[model samples]
Target: MSSTLLAPVLEREEYIEQAYFFRTLAERLREGVPAQMALLQIRDELLTTTRLPWAVEFLATELKHSGQLGSGMKRLIHYFTPFQAFVMTKAEEEGVRFSLDHALKVLEGEARYRSENPTPAGLFVYEFEVLARCQLGYQNGLDCMEQDSFFDEDWRQFIETVRRSMSEVEFADLIYLYSEQYIQDQQRAGREGPFPRPLFGLKEGRIAKASHGRDPLYLFAALQRQLGYPEVPRLRLPTEQRGVLQMLEHKVRELELRLRLLEGEVRGQVEVIQALGKPETAESSLEWLKRLDNEE
Candidate 1:
């Protein structure tokens, strides 16, 4: 990763404000506020002393011109992490199932974690969980994680190694091998050669060992449950929201049927015209209704 591409580690207050900004923006979006409007509104809510307000202003300007928040964020690499920009970019992509609200919530959780005294190991787990759970491409996701200034050189090297051979290696084994417990066991067995520095603690190693050969999500769950690591947010619409979406889908299907009927009428299909037009006989009208139902 290029040094210039990586944003410097931000202050605790900056992260605090960022968490607030993301959380507020996501909430507003869920409530149906426009993105540009949300940014303008959030700009005034940020601390005047922090650089976030200026970034918000620029984002608003960019949103007006290009109608995309990710484009603006990508240009502000000096302020936002590459991972943040990448998440927003994915959210805004056409045909991607990921929602912008979910992306903001992800960033909000990350910033909130950063505001606290977060350990490098915990931060790495949280980030990796996001990539895994969201099905974000591991290649770019690991690259972004590696470039984050919050992690040191050792962490970057390990992350790059994971990116290269993630498909070949078992995730649990990877964690266990780099853990202190592994080193202790090796020393007890009288192994002679030097070992790489341990990135995970003994407890993490034990969890990984227990979770071996299982789904990696199990390992992530154990870490969050036992070690107080930050949990990645899952995107699920509420019951009411899902119902509304179903209703809209039904309405769209109805519209499509009507459009098809119109096209058939234009082409002078006798059955389509009879289905759409009033019939002279009640029996004919019943037959038309039956045909329409069958088409539906």
Candidate 2:
């Protein structure tokens, strides 16, 4: 993919923090730590951090897209950068491989990808592609981890000691670095957005009244049904909906004018027919008789 497209994917800090978090959790789990405790720690860390909650929201979406949380988490770790990859245990590696293999099989069978065979492969291919990229990143991180210790201590061991040894402030800074690096990597990959665009569904216009008579609040509520609201405060409705209503009114007026024109034409035709049936005056009657004699 072009660097531009990859920039958005890689630029988000949350993706990086997630990689770090997953790597840490996977390592602890492999070493026999309770999964529930690991998850609780991760959640706690995110809540205590300023930027982490927003980042989690994005990660959650990616996870859902890669098929539920379990599959998504596996894919996330597998896709980490080379340095990030070293944190995964053998089991995590195996999970990633399985997900990747399944995805490739699905792709091979897809009609869009196959030359001789066609099937309604559905849109699952998109998910497969996304997961594949995540797995690739994790493989890269693994390669990096094998070369040298990226951090002062073994990352797996560090995670195991995190609760007892690291203070909230220290942990926050580490998380921040990890998040920054992840976002930077994504930026390097050309996965970040063009930036400065209003967040999705936050345009400055009023909800158009023509949209099923939905007010801005109602339209926003409808949007919430599809994409949950962002962490940001609620947005007010714009005046654009009024413009839409005005346009609809104009169309109605045009139709009424056309109807009047049609009615007038029909009325003129009736008037001509009624005049033709009227009895002729004496002068007109004499003229008609003269015209008949001339024809004879």
Name the top TM-score candidate. Answer: 1
Largest lDDT belongs to which candidate?
Answer: 1
TM-score of structure candidate 1: 0.81
Tell me the spans in candidate 1 whose CA falls farther than 4 Å from its real position: 2-4, 239-296
Q: What lDDT does candidate 1 reach at residue 83? A: 90
lDDT tens digits by residue: candidate 2, 1-296 = 10111111132344445535544554555457655555556666663443444434444565455523334323343233222222222224554543322322222222122222211111111222222334434233323333322222343333333334333324222322333333444578888754322211222121212223333344344333443321112222325657677677766655554454365456664344343332244324334334433533
TM-score, per-candidate, Cα-based:
0.81, 0.21
State in Å the error of residue 149, model 2.
25
- Candidate RMSDs in order: 6.3, 26.0
Worst 10 residues of 1 by lDDT: 278-287
Could you give me the TM-score of model 2 versus the true structure? 0.21
- Candidate 1 lDDT, 34-85, residue by residue in tens: 8889999999999999999999999999989998999998899889998999
Tell me the lDDT of candidate 2: 0.35
**CA lDDT of each candidate?**
0.86, 0.35
